[model samples]
Target: MSIVVPVYQGERTLRALIDEILPLTSRTYSPSGRPLVVEEVLLVFDHGPDGSADVIRELVSDHSFVRGVWLSRNFGQHPATLAGMASSGGEWIVTMDEDGQHDPADIGGLLDTALDRQSSVVYAKPTNAAPHGLWRNAASRGSKWLIATAMGADSTVSYQSYRLVLGEVGRSVAAYAGSEAYLDVALGWIAGEVTTSPVELREEHGRRSGYNVRTLLSHFWRMVLSSGTKGLRLVSFIGVAFAILGLVLVLWVLASYLLFDVGTEVQGWASTMVILLFGFGATLFSLGVVAEYVGVNVKTAMGKPPYLIVADPADGPLGRTATRPEPPEHTTPT
Candidate 1:
């Protein structure tokens, strides 16, 4: 099985992550007597301002299994992960954060569950974690809740990136045609025999996280949009609700005009204003959602590489590629 670690500015912890996982490759074994030899650890470096790319290139030269996939530029986490999976040669694929927040030990458990269930994807669910600030926790919960509501509560909540996937299944998902590639949502689409096991989140040291509020919001929006018809269905329901409300108001106005004599200023002006504002708002909101759908299709049709391969050794069979046909256009200036 191969492990893929998508490194984006993970300078402080990347070395440790590699050190911890490399030994597990040889130590972990299945009952079938096949030892887990990590055929390759595809470290996809999305050329960030951090000097991580240079460090990873040196690491790759020193270790045969430590292959560096340098992207021409940043293409966000999901796309970079897909690129790493594309480059790896393992029959099984495992993805984990380069930051030590996700324990490498969980990989063994995830693998065990995958083998036991004969499952396509064995996701490591987060069991416990050190407390984060309230807003951060709330945002995290919101993200998970949205995923659970869309995918299924059983399949989501307490979800972790630490996962083991059958090689063929991973490739099949990677081939899924969508510009907004949210990993969890994408996995939700290909719901093969899937199961989850609980794993404790490691204590995070005082390093700043890569994903801030803006990034999180962007990711959440992509997830909602990529979640498929459930989102559209929700929009449809909302539209119907608004249409009914508008009809009810109109009927009430007609009744007042015909018999009740409720006065034009009170009923006509206020009701008209309320109905006009809400009706127009709802119409625009619905159009925005529709536009999001159209935008994804249009972006996919543009034939761009989802990411770029920046720094693989010349002789090595580099495994990663961008999502669109065109690669990311820049590397970190260094």
Candidate 2:
């Protein structure tokens, strides 16, 4: 097992986090008795304005399992996490933030959730409200609501930092993820089964959140774009609905003279202008969606993978063979 932590400004909190995690490595963490071990704790440094690099160096030198994965520059949280996953050699990988909001004690519950559900991935669902300002919490909920409505997605598609991923799936996603990819969304593409475990989030130990309002909004938009054809489908649906509405309006106009006359006694000019404005707005919105997709695809075409390995990972619960339940060897007569 590996814990891949993406660090932005964690100089003060990392030591405490590591100390908490170290105790677990010496004991059992899996309820299924699957023989799990914490082989590595990878702290990915994203070059923030702090002494994190120096702290990471000290941690690497102090603990045998602790290792530092440094990026050339700041590449944001998901990319830094992917970089760590790409380099990990463990059979399972757990991705969490460095802010200490995610408690280390809950890792055992994550493992149990995955094993009991026979799932490829398990996400942590906080039972209490997130430790953020009221407006920030509201915005987060609003964005999630918008995503679920627009994309026709279920609760499993929610964004979560504390997640346990199958080793092969984690590494494969890290390799093939596009430039603007969201980590959780990328995981959803191939994870055959996913579930969530309820946990309580602890407050950050007197630490300020790294994300400001503008940064959070930008991050949300990137996630929206990374949803992969969902936004485009939404636009398509809107366009179709508008076409149907226009057809109904046209039929109503025709019926006004032929049958029970209504909604067309006034001059047609006002209605015509309203129709024109609606059509133009829809057309421009569709064009904008298309342009956004084109730009993302162009980036994918240009960016090469950062890491490569000789072969696939060992078989786990999400393996092709594992996904299919085995038949009973014998059956009793009914």
Candidate 3:
């Protein structure tokens, strides 16, 4: 087993989190009753304003099984996670937050569930309400619902940070992920089966959430965009509906003019303007959708890699000296 965590400002909680996780590396057993030893813990640091880099260096020096990967800079949560996945070499890979909210003890349960159900991925679903204010929780649910509806996924999937994925599947998804890839959505695309296990979510030890309202909204928008082209299909449906309505309106106008001798002059300019404005708005909306799809295609054609690792554990104690080979330069399409 390999445990991967994306560390941001986790200086205070990392020690405790590692201590809890290290013990599980020895005591846990697999489904076949063999001792399940965690081969290594890959901590990928997403450059943040904290001393976590030093902390990780110290931890790596003391523990043999602990390895570190340092990114060139902060690459958001999902990208950092992909970096960790790329570095992991184990039969199963477990990912969790650095805030210490995910209990290390739940690893056994998650593993058992995954093995029993033969699932490629298992998410740790919160058994109780999340540790947040009512309004915040409601907004979180609403965002998740929007993503689910847009992606045509089951809303009950309950995507979360704490998850267990088969090693091969995780690496494959990370390798092929594009610049705008959302981890969960990518997993859904490649995973053979996905399920969830009930777990209690603990509150953060001493810090508030890393995300605020504005960041959360941006995150939600990115998730919708990364899921797929379903949003464009939705716009196409709306355009069709508007076209049908416009046809009906034209028929009504023609029938009124022929049967009752009512013409455009009797209907007045206000009604005419309303119909014209609606048509104009719908046309502009469709164009905007098309533009978005074109932008995505251009980025893909330019060969945008999802994540880059500037440092790895094989380098030395700090793992800050290693570097990945440069990716091929972007080439213009014919």
Q: Which candidate number would show the highest lDDT if scored against the true structure?
A: 3
Candidate 2's TM-score reads 0.82
lDDT of each: 0.75, 0.84, 0.86
**Backbone Cα, N, C clashes tallied per candidate:** 14, 0, 0
Q: Rank the candidates by TM-score, best first.
A: 3, 1, 2
Instruction: Write model 1 residue lDDT over 67-125, tens digit each, in one string.
Output: 88767678988888888887777888998887788877666677777777778888887
In the range 1-334, model 3's lDDT, one tens digit per residue, is: 8999999888898898999988876766754564677889998999878888888988999899888888877788888999999999999999999998899888888888888899999999999998888888999999888777766876878989999999999999999988777789889998987999999999987877788899788677667767778878888898899889989988987788788866456555798899889989988988887787777678888997777888543465664665888999999999
- How far in Å is the alpha carbon of 319 misplaced in model 1? 21
In order of appearance, the predictions have TM-scores of 0.85, 0.82, 0.86
lDDT value, residue 256 of candidate 2: 76
* Candidate 2, lDDT over the whole model: 0.84
